[model samples]
Target: MATNVLICDDSSFARKQMARAIPKEWEVDIHFAGDGVEGVQAIREGKGEVVFLDLTMPNLDGYGVLETIRKEDLPAMVIVVSGDIQPDAQDRVKKLGAMAFIKKPIDAEKAREVLTEYGILTGA
Candidate 1:
C-alpha cells in the first residue's frame, strides 16, 4: 500500500525539494500545504500518515501543529524539516513529539536514514 505523506512549507520551492528528497523506491501519495494550518488540516483528514513539517510558516507554524497533534492525540508521525539549525530548536521539536528533524535543503540520504532508523520507512 502507498503511504500518505504530507510536506508542509510556506515555500513552493521547499515543497518541491522535499518531494524530490523522498526515496524513489518508496510508494507514497504526496500532499502539499503552504503553511502549518493547512498542514494540520491535512493531517486530520488522514492525508498525512507521515508529515514533513516546516518550522516557520504563516498560519500556525510547526510548533503549533506539533502541539495540536499532541493535544489531540493525532496518529501522524511528524518529521520537522527546517532551515533553523539551532540545537534548541531541534530539541524543542523532539519534545513536542516530532519523530525527527532534518535541516533545510534536505538531503535524500539523511532523510532516508532517519526514516529507516526510526522504522517509519520500510522495504524502500
Candidate 2:
C-alpha cells in the first residue's frame, strides 16, 4: 500500500523542496498544509499517515500543532523538520511524541534516510 504523507510548512518553497525530495519509487500520496492551524485541521480531516512538520510558522507553530495532535490523539506519525537543531528543542519535540526530528534545509538524501529509518520507505 502507498504511504500517505502530509507536508506542513508555511513556506511554499520549503514545501516544494520537501515534495521534490521524496523518492518517486516510494509510492507516497502527498498532501500539504500551509501552517500549523491548517495542519491540525488537516489531521482532524484525516489527511495522511505521516506529517512532516515545520517548527517556525505563523498562527500556531509546530510545537502547538504537536500538542494539539497529542491532546486529540491524532493517529499520524509526526516527523519534525526544522532549522532549529538545538538540544532542548529536540528534547521537547521528542517528548511530545514525534517519531523523528530532522533538521531543515532538507536534502533528498536526508529525506530518504529519515523515511527509511521511520519505516515509511522500504528498499531502494
Candidate 3:
C-alpha cells in the first residue's frame, strides 16, 4: 500500500522543496497543506500517516498541529521540518509527539537518514 504523506508549510516554495526531499524509497501519495488548519483537516480526511510539518504558518503553526494531533489522538507520525532550529522548539515538538525533527532547508540525504532511523524507511 502506498503511504499517505502530508507536507504542511506556508511557503509554496518550501512545500515543493519538501516534496522533492522525500526519499524515493517511500512509496507515497503525497498531499499538501498550506497551514496547520489544513494540515489537521487533511489528517482527519485520512491523508496523513507520515507528516512533514513546518513550524511557522498562518491560521495555525506546527505546534498547534501537534497539539491537535495529540489531543484528538490522530494516528499520524509528525516529522517537524522547520527554519526554527532552537533546542526548545525541537524538545517541544518531541514532547507533543513528533517522531522526528529536520531543519530547513532540508537535505534529502539527511532526511533519508532520519526516516531510516525512525523506521519509516529501511536502509536498503
Candidate 4:
C-alpha cells in the first residue's frame, strides 16, 4: 500500500525539493500544503500519514501544527524540515512530538536514514 505523505511548506521550491528527497522505492501518495492550516486540514482528511513540515509559515507555523496534532491526538508522524537549525528549535519540536528534524535543503540520504530509523521505510 502507498503511504499518504504531506509536505507542508510556504515555499513551493522547498516543497519540490522535499518531494524529490523521498526515497524512490517508497510507495507514497504525496500531498502539498502551503501552510499549517492547510496542513492540519490535510491531516484530518487523511492525506497525511507522515508529514514533512516547515517551521516558519504564515498563520499556524510548525509548532502550532504539532500542538494541534497532540491536542487532537491526531495519528500522523511529523518530521520537521526547516532552515531553523537551532538546538532549542529542535528540542522544542521533539518535545512537541516530531519524529525528527531535518535541516533545510534536505538531503536524500539523511531523509532515508530517518525514515529507516523510524521504520517508515524498510529494506536496504
- 1-124, model 4: which lDDT tens digit per residue? 8999999999999999999999999999999999999999999999999999999999999999999999999999999999999999999999999999999889999999999999999974
Q: Go through the candidates in order and give each one's C-alpha lDDT.
A: 0.94, 0.90, 0.93, 0.97
* Model 2 steric clash total: 0
**Regions of model 2 farther than 4 Å from truth:** none
Worst 10 residues of 1 by lDDT: 115-124
lDDT of each residue in 9-114, candidate 3, tens digit only: 9999999999998888788999999999999999999899999999999999999999999999999999999999999999999999999999999899989999
TM-score of 2: 0.94
| lDDT of each residue in 1-124, candidate 1, tens digit only | 8899999999999999999999988889999999988998999999999999999999799999999999988889999999999999999999999999999889999999998999877874
Model 2 per-residue lDDT tens digits across residues 1-124? 7777899999999999989988889887899999999999988887858899999999999999999999989988999999999999999999998989889898888888888887778876
lDDT, residue 34, candidate 2: 98
Q: Residue 54 in candidate 4 has what lDDT?
A: 99
Q: Which stretches of candidate 4 lie over 4 Å from their true place?
A: none
Q: CA shift at 104, candidate 1, in angstroms?
A: 1.0
Q: Which of the two, 2 or 3, has more lDDT?
A: 3
Query: By TM-score, who's the top model here?
Result: 4
Sorted on lDDT, best first, the list reads 4, 1, 3, 2
Candidate 1 wrong stretches, greater than 4 Å: none
State every prediction's TM-score relative to the real structure: 0.97, 0.94, 0.96, 0.98
> What clash pairs does model 3 have?
none
- How far in Å is the alpha carbon of 76 misplaced in model 1? 0.7
Model 2 weakest 10-residue run by lDDT: 115-124
Model 3: weakest 10-residue lDDT segment is 115-124
